[model samples]
Target: MVSQEKKIKVVLAQFPLETHNRGIITVAGMLRDAGMEVVLMGNARAEQIIKVAVQEFADVVGISSYCGGELALGDELLTMAEREGIRDHTVFILGGIFPPKDAPKLKEIGFSATFPPSATREEITSSIKSAIAARSLG
Candidate 1:
């Protein structure tokens, strides 16, 4: 029914359910401008996010959490990724309101990339490229 286009399918779970969500819309636009398929899942259920990611066969997942719960949620997300068997192929990126000091902690939990707040679009793009490059090398 629909056309199959080759684009970087992304699910943006970046932003609290109560916020205006303009930031995520902007970020999604940027990724779209870069020729990547972007899906904005504002305040979606965790299981739904996981289900959609698995069903869509998304190439990347972008989570945005700025609150204190990111630590716990991040860990749970990694666990969900593993359960879905997309841990290796999907590009796992976390963005928004992140503290740089915790990068190691997220990295340790199998996150392929982390984009803290104030990070430029180029930085995020570069991270994805780097992940692709690294995957190719290994």
Candidate 2:
């Protein structure tokens, strides 16, 4: 586990208007257990999530999309983050019910990582840590 001083601060949100929150809630628990500070912003719009990320000084911003609009949502969030000037320091990740093909598209849209429902707890935590590390290095 990381020490308190080095804990990765993450702000997690569900895509705007999305109702399937169980996956993100579970991920919040997993991240906390992994020693990262997680702020779960349930069902917030892209703008609200970006505001919270800035307020929290988040190292990572994660969105879970159970709905089919992952591409649009991801683009919107990235645009907002860029506007808020957190795009460089923040690692953006997306998860939940998206097509396998959309994963690459999401990445192209500025998500640092993408996860399907099949992603394991270890994979999620490890990927988040790695992304944070890479961001710091760059």
Candidate 3:
């Protein structure tokens, strides 16, 4: 039987190195409320994907890029996960100011979902829940 506490490991990747950590924190709180274990990342880092995953024991990673480097950043995260043999276990999500043209490309690169800045909190919450459910089913 599943435990009453549903823990969802999450990583929030915001960009450039400065700005309010509000979005990350907000989503983290919501996930936690939904019984998830959330791990958040700030700014950009080549090594942070693996590092954060290892540190968080993440089931999923939420990468946000307000900066212009989201596509490359998201791919790097997925590549790191694949190399570490963690891909099968981690669901990847990209959020923030993504260029529409690059959206499908990011998905092609392995992001399970993409959310622009306007995406609602409820949408994100539902997405997380759906990912968790899908992971369990698969």
Candidate 4:
């Protein structure tokens, strides 16, 4: 759990081709209610997401994917973060339409967590909180 002493900041984005913003919006509200700051990037390019994350001084970058291309995009996002020198500073998470079988691949690609379609609000919020706490410590 993230202590109330600091407000965690998260940047939420979806894979470029995905237009479904409802989940992202709902997650944003949940994060805010949990006392974290959130910025939703609504279907953005990897570079754009990274730029905003850096600008916002984000603690976590949560990306939602629904088109089965999360593995490639997740790898690209991690590579970009490494190149930009923010790999260790930011935690990356993937949510929406992910299969249980692909969770390991997502983690190997540097995603901090992967939430399947049925993930509850508590699970998502707790994951974000945990990531933020871990990042702050290390």
Candidate 5:
């Protein structure tokens, strides 16, 4: 009998005020095509995203920011996740328009990875899969 790997469950969200969503929408479709299950939450607040992540038992929590203030949003989301007790198992990733210098800051704030606009589809999917796998091992 062939054994199938469990599908990775991901919750994708954007800050409630963020209006640039085309990239995130495309990413959601890409993740789904990569055999992962994705729950896309449009214009969601940090708390809402955390609630959904918990309810969905999501392996990954992805946030997209295009209207700026990614650092603050990322920090807020991580704080909320930590408060909700899901910080240990869930992989957090950030994507969208942000200063290149902010990537390390985001990672330091607890995002597992950050993707710039130039990131390829393969890179995003592979990194997410790798992060989830690493988290499981850890």
Candidate 6:
């Protein structure tokens, strides 16, 4: 694990779809275990995610979407973040079932990182740490 002088705060947005919660919860556990502060926002809209991120002073907003509408939702999240003026300060991440081919599009929409459902716990945790560190550097 990377040596962190300050704990990174991450807010994981729950997908509106019911079946997707399992992996999101698992990732939340992994993130919390990795020495970061994690808040799992249950069934939240993009607006709520942005609001909560600001309120929590979160460094990253992580979403695990497995319902196949990630592209649209991810775009919406970015738009909301931009509108709320947190687009630069907050790192947005997506994991779970997003097609690999669409990662570039997601990045273009301001996603800091994107992970497939095949990502291991180590990968998810490491990506969050890396994104937070990168954002801090810039």
lDDT of each: 0.76, 0.90, 0.74, 0.85, 0.92, 0.83
Per-residue lDDT of model 6, residues 15-106, tens digit only? 56647587888888888887888898878888888999888888899988876888888888889888888888888998888678989999
- Evaluate candidate 5 by giving its C-alpha RMSD to the native, one decimal: 1.4
lDDT of 3 by residue, 32-78 (tens): 77676666667657466677776778878887666576777667777
* lDDT digits (tens) for residues 1-138 of candidate 5: 453988899999899999899999999999998889999998899999999999999999998888788898788999999999999999999999898899899989999999998888899999998898898899
Tell me how far the alpha carbon of residue 31 in candidate 2 is from the true structure, in angstroms, after superposition.
0.5
Candidate 6 lDDT: 0.83
User: Which is better, 5 or 6, measured by lDDT?
Assistant: 5
Residue 52 displacement (Å), model 1:
0.6
Deviation in angstroms for 15 in model 3? 4.6
TM-scores, each model vs. reference: 0.85, 0.95, 0.81, 0.91, 0.96, 0.90
Off by over 4 Å in 1: 1-5, 15-20
- The true-structure Cα RMSD of candidate 3 reads 2.7
Query: Candidate 3 has what TM-score?
Result: 0.81
For model 3, which pairs clash? 6-35, 8-36, 8-37
Q: Write the per-residue lDDT of candidate 2 for residues 15-122, one digit (tens) a residue.
A: 768989889999999989888899998988899999999999999998998879889878988999999999989999999998899989998999989999989989
Clashes of each: 1, 0, 3, 0, 0, 0
Model 1 lDDT vs. the true structure?
0.76
In the range 3-47, model 1's lDDT, one tens digit per residue, is: 486667888885345354655777788888877888888886566
Q: lDDT, candidate 3, residue 120?
A: 78
Where is model 4 more than 4 Å wrong at Cα?
A: 1-4
lDDT winner: 5
